[model samples]
Target: MKKFIATLLAFGLVATLGACGAKESETTNPPAATGETGATDTTETTELQTIKVAATPVPHAEILNACVDMMAEKGYKLEVTEYSDYIIPNTAVEDGEEDANFFQHTPYLDQFNTDNGTHLVSVAKIHYEPMGIYPGKSASIEEVPDGGTVAVPNDVTNEARALQLLAAQGLIEIDPEAGLNATPKDITSNPKNLEFTELEAAMLPNTVEEFDLNVINSNFAMAAGLNPATDALASEGADSEGAQTYANVLVVKEGNEDNEAVKALIECLTSDETRAFIEETYGGAVVPVF
Candidate 1:
């Protein structure tokens, strides 16, 4: 009986050793980490390489925030920094703190580049805020009393645009050649003898009630509940020189024009979804490029 028990025990040990050998052979070529199945771990690590952008509060940042998902598909992240002031965004992009910025027109961007020696360039045209000529106490352009005040933005470039808009309306005539540089002094014909009140752009809406007529920027008009398409007595044509020159642009430092992340952002701005958002949300005050 003892001999038979020893024989069974030895056979059991041999079987156990065979089973362990087979298990080791199966795992000899372990599965490779193709960086695919571990998608969660890959995403958690790659999500850290986000591209930062600076934008204004109105539509720039708002529009960019809507594109986060589209960027993620390309393994990129977008971070938008809202800036209320116009000057800082450009500066931020130039300093490399921001990868790109939105909120200025081609003219403004060109001027900023020229004045500051920053090589910022427009990557895409996003939208344009139409300039509107709103009615004031004078009621009508035909009845403007002599020396009646006409309010315009005081900033250099905008003041010029206001004058051109007035020129387009036949309220005044400017030297056709003066272009965006045309100042109040560039007016060659003013049949109404309308006195011009130059105030900060933001103040134009409030000053309208006090002036004969006010040429308010679309931003301020929207804030004051004035719709360019509905409330303005006159407005710039969609294809006017103003539209081409002052179309709000997405900007990046000169060499970054070819950046893949920036290209994605440009694609986002020019997308159909962004176009619909601009049209539906801003009425005619903001027109989409695409």
Candidate 2:
């Protein structure tokens, strides 16, 4: 009987040892269940990089800011710096302080690049701000009396566009040789003998009451609560050369055209939400080119 009790106690001791071994194994190498390591939950795995850009306040920055969520999905952050003047934004991008800029059109960019010797190039044409003729004194092109003064943007390219739109309405005629660069000097026929007043583009809206008619850019017009589609006496054709060639663009230093971040921003800007925002917010003042 004593021998039998000894064997039973030995078996109990072995069983206890086995249980301890199993507990150690479990503690040392625990099994991964749902939502454990090596799973597809990206909560702690993926992080996004940030991309900075410079833009004008009126629409460029606002448009870009609208794409934040879209860009985030692609693992990028869009930081937009609003610039008041035209020169600083491009300069900032050229100096690598900004990844890109979206304020100027292709023609303006081309001219700026030529003038400043900057190596900037347009990657995508996003939208165009239509040039419109607004009424202050004259309700229509025909109503303007002879020798009445018309206010136009004093810039070379903008003035040309204004003159072209006026010519399209048959209110005046310009020299065919002048092309997009048409100026007051290019006006060959002026039956009304109306005088043209040149003013800074940004100030055109504020000084609208000072002139019989104001040829204003879409941005300034919008700020002045004038909708180009509904309020303008006349506007540039939607398919005009100015609309296409001067379409606002995403610009970067020439060599960075193929940059991954810049390409992603282009994709985001041309996205559905961005297009919808431009159409709805600008109310046809800004047309998407993509």
Candidate 3:
């Protein structure tokens, strides 16, 4: 009887050891991935798409900077390259060095493509910086003496725009057929007999003091401490044909019109926030065309 009881006790001890070992094994090595662990492991991460854009310094870069946060929210990152000259932006886009540019108008783009044989297109019309006639030696158009020297941009498109602005104010009459491509030779009427001196668009600001009146592009005018809204002797009105025709545009390489990243950029630029920012910041010097 004593031996039987001892045997029974030994058996009970072995069973307890086995149960503890099993419990430890369960703790150390979890069961193969069950549905519980595997089902909850579905965290997803989205990668942001990056787009590079070239722009002018003042309003274009400022406007693009404002949209950075808004774009990031949409899974896109905007990288802006500021260019002071108008030529490089388009060339950069054409060469694929930049994804898009924001410093030119449709007419200028058309002329550039024609001139350089680059394939570029406008993605969206952003703003209009009205060409303005600013005072140099003369305070007003009527005050200018006959045969007064007026400075204009040498670039084909902008010189044409400058002439058009003068024509709009009755200072001159451009050949109706010449239209946006008009040159000084296209002038059919010049009651003031104003002599046009064509210079680099960027040089017009510094040379303004030398001429009787200067037809300055709004961007250059603003850069030279002149305000198109107030300092300009005369400016293109928001409703003027020039304003509608020369609205500065967002441009891209021809085939990138439907690019997803470019589309996101356009959406941010044309957003209500961007419109309000332009209206408030530039006060009328830069008009939002939507």
Candidate 4:
């Protein structure tokens, strides 16, 4: 079967009043009514609140950028700060330096919380970017010789995701019960005896040429101008176990998931406007779950 490069988008809220094709409700002002002082009763407009979010440069930051103006219209200033690596974004949220973050999936977040004892949690499922095995030195899967080196993400969850993708290609075999956290040690069979090299997920795209094949997360592939749909020798699919387990999420410190700004941000992110943006900007590379 031909594998797919998964795309992802988020889901939340009932409707939006402005932007991204979310139309405002039509209303007519009632004839002016005078109060005891013969003055019209007026409602005070709520002040705009600014919320900080951390994201990766490619689709995460780009996707969030599409919602900035729409968020502002909804009484929130959506400030997105871009980070190249995975660690700081979560740490920043844990330390209360960022209001929330976008760019990672639930499994990564769960592992980070367990590994670091941080209090981050996912509030909404956004999109899923399928991991893909992109060519480094080898041009195609069949061309990868025995003893080939495959660079993979070092982080526990992602590394397992990469290994699983490779296993699906019949390039390797791993212990079946190891599941999402499986690693190279779980490989029960290596038909080609491919060597695995672990690296931080962000570094794979920049250094892909140094290896035989690199398992790259779609977001980084996108940033490096590698479209997994076209460039990958093999890729994960939407219906794959990883996709159902790894939809990118909007993460926040556990206690603050219900903040007003966070709620509005969720509304804008999952709004029709954002769904359209994901579809147009990323094509099939960033599929919207909503």
Candidate 5:
């Protein structure tokens, strides 16, 4: 009977030891239910980098918004801030308040950098808005009376573009030597005796009807509900030098032009998808330069 009792005690001790050993094994190693090489319940997620950019309304912001999903797929969060005035965008980039800007063309950038002493450089040529001659009081260029009032952009380069466009249309003649810098004073002849009244580019659209004719930038025209392709009397051709000279660009502080985020944004803006969006959305108003 003592031997039997010893046997029972021995079995009990063995069973208890087995249970403890099983528990310890479970505590040290866990089964990876996820089925990865090493099973772990702990999960880690990657965060996206944020790229802040400044842009004008119309095509720049519209174009950038379309690329948000593309940027995310490439692991970046694109944030755009809209500005009405041109100065703030470049200054914002120069002051480090923005990663980049997408509004002004390289010519405007060169002028801004020279005037404000800002160090901004273009990373990519995105698109160009052809300057269009939108009729106001005059139903057509031919209907304009002698000394008809014309509204033109006050900015230097744009004013020259306006004059060049008028000259090209045979409304007036300007010195060929003046080139892109032609102004009202550079007119070599005036067939209609048209008088130019200079105003801020953005304001031309608002008071368009008050003048006989208004030379408006494509962006401002579109913002005021005018389609350049259908509404304007005339605009730049796709093969025009304006395509290169006035093409809107992705710009950044000179030193940051080559940064990874800026490069990514450039890639997205110049992508085939972006080109398709521009062609379909703006028609001929905005042309992709890339």
Candidate 6:
């Protein structure tokens, strides 16, 4: 009877120890996951977009440079490529090699698109650089000798602007129908009987001294160390229709007008800060139209 009780007690002790071991295993080792795979939830990070623009070296690139930090703050990068000629910038944008361009006005852009068969559009009109009649051999309009030559830009849009400036100064009269697309053929009356020399817009500055007076684009005039606000014998007034019509604009490919990067650029360009910069930098040679 005593042996039987001791054996039973030993069996009970073994079972208790086994149960405790099983409990500890459950607490420490846990059950192996059955037919289940672990998964990690992750989010993708998006990279910022870069905007590339073609621009003239003067006020356009300089103005874009000022907006670089502002764009970066808004999570974008602005890359400005300087272009000396007018043709390549529009072509670059049309070909998608550049995101936008900033060297031309609406009329010039319209003419370019029509002539090149490219679908480019303006996103914003930023500023205007008045077309000025700068004296070369002649100091004033009154001093221009009869039949003296007056140089003008050979391009269609700029030639019209030059004619308009001449008309404004009473040196000549343009047909009312010629409007912004006028040429020498559109001239109705020439009081001075001045001869017109049509040359490339960029060449006007260099040839200014050769002609009695040269109609100079403000950018080229500034590049030649002439101030349109001061040195010009006659310039388009701020309130003039020409000033409103010839304001330089931000341009992009037609379908990309609403692109986020382009939108950001337009915002930066038209901001009050940019306006102030134009006023301070060019000293009214370039007037903010935004």
Candidate whose TM-score is highest: 5
Off by over 4 Å in 5: 1-43
Best by lDDT: 6
TM-score of each predicted structure versus truth:
0.80, 0.83, 0.83, 0.83, 0.87, 0.82
Cα RMSD (angstroms) for every candidate in the order listed: 5.0, 4.6, 6.4, 20.9, 4.3, 9.3
How many clashing residue pairs are found in candidate 3? 0
List model 3 lDDT by residue over 1-290, tens digit each. 99999999999999999999999997786566447744433347788888999987877888899999999999988999988888999999999999999988898899999999999999899999989898888878888998899999998888888898899888899899998889999999988788989998878889877999998888877776788889888888778777889999999999999999988999999999999999998998998888
Query: Model 1: how large is the Cα RMSD against the reference?
Result: 5.0
Local distance difference test, each candidate: 0.83, 0.86, 0.89, 0.89, 0.88, 0.90
lDDT for model 6, please: 0.90
TM-score of 4: 0.83
Ranking 1 against 5 by TM-score, winner: 5
Q: Write down the worst ten-residue block by lDDT for model 3.
A: 34-43
**Which of the predicted structures, 1 or 2, would earn the higher TM-score when compared with the native?**
2
Tell me which residue pairs clash in candidate 6.
none
lDDT of model number 5: 0.88
Of 3 and 5, which scores higher on TM-score?
A: 5
Question: What are the per-residue Cα lDDT tens digits for candidate 5 across 100-120?
Answer: 998888888898888999999
* lDDT (Cα, tens digit) per residue for candidate 4, span 1-290: 12322221112222231343433222334335466566565666687789999999989999899999999898888999999999999999999999999999988988889999999989998888988999989988899999999999999999999999999999998899998989999999998989999999999999988999999999999999999788888888889999889999999998998999999999988999999999898878888997
Worst 10 residues of 4 by lDDT: 5-14
Error of 2 at 286 (Å): 1.6
Model 1 scores a TM of 0.80
- lDDT of each residue in 86-161, candidate 1, tens digit only: 7889999999999999888888788778888998998888889888889999777676787878999887788889
Off by over 4 Å in 1: 1-45, 138-143, 223-225
Point out where model 4 deviates above 4 Å.
1-47
